[model samples]
Target: MANSNDSWFQTTAAREIHLEQLKQAERFNGRAAMLGIVIGIITEGLTGAGIAHQIGLGPLVDGYAACRTQFLPFCF
Candidate 1:
């Protein structure tokens, strides 16, 4: 605990770093969310590709068809 006369600067550097990291965390939450969404899209797209392959739609169309879930982002 700190006295009234003491500034937070009086705390250990590790404690200060922890508080800084918390502040940084607030900024990173949105970035993390976006990253998760991107990962989800990629996984879903790969899944679609596997389905296309299983259906034997031919390599070209099937390859594209499989990943169309990902392409939806651009086609929109």
Candidate 2:
């Protein structure tokens, strides 16, 4: 009976530890995703490639049009 109880306790402890590690990993991944979004916004702002420019195809539209038939959407 004592041996059985000891084995059960050990299994429970290991399970708890594994659960805690998984929670910590989830938090870290959430933070990393947020950090990536912030960095992406910063990059777009600095590079002047905001939503408007991207949707309008700004300076690259001409290139695309020039080879639209050749590349299906991209020139060269």
lDDT of each: 0.64, 0.76
Candidate 2 Cα deviation (angstroms), residue 51: 9.8
Estimate the lDDT of model 2.
0.76
**What would the per-residue lDDT of candidate 1 be over residues 1-76, giving only the tens digit for each residue?**
5574375555666698899999899779978988877776776587754433444654545356446656333332
lDDT score of residue 7 within candidate 2 = 100
- In order of appearance, the predictions have TM-scores of 0.33, 0.62
Residue pairs with backbone overlap in model 1: 49-66
Clashing pairs in 2: none
RMSD of 2: 6.5
Q: Write down the worst ten-residue block by lDDT for model 1.
A: 67-76
Root-mean-square deviation of every model: 10.6, 6.5
List model 2 lDDT by residue over 12-62, tens digit each.
999999999999999999999999778768868888776445567654545
Q: How many angstroms is residue 44 displaced in model 2 relative to the true structure, after the best TM-score fit?
A: 0.9
Off by over 4 Å in 1: 1-22, 49-76
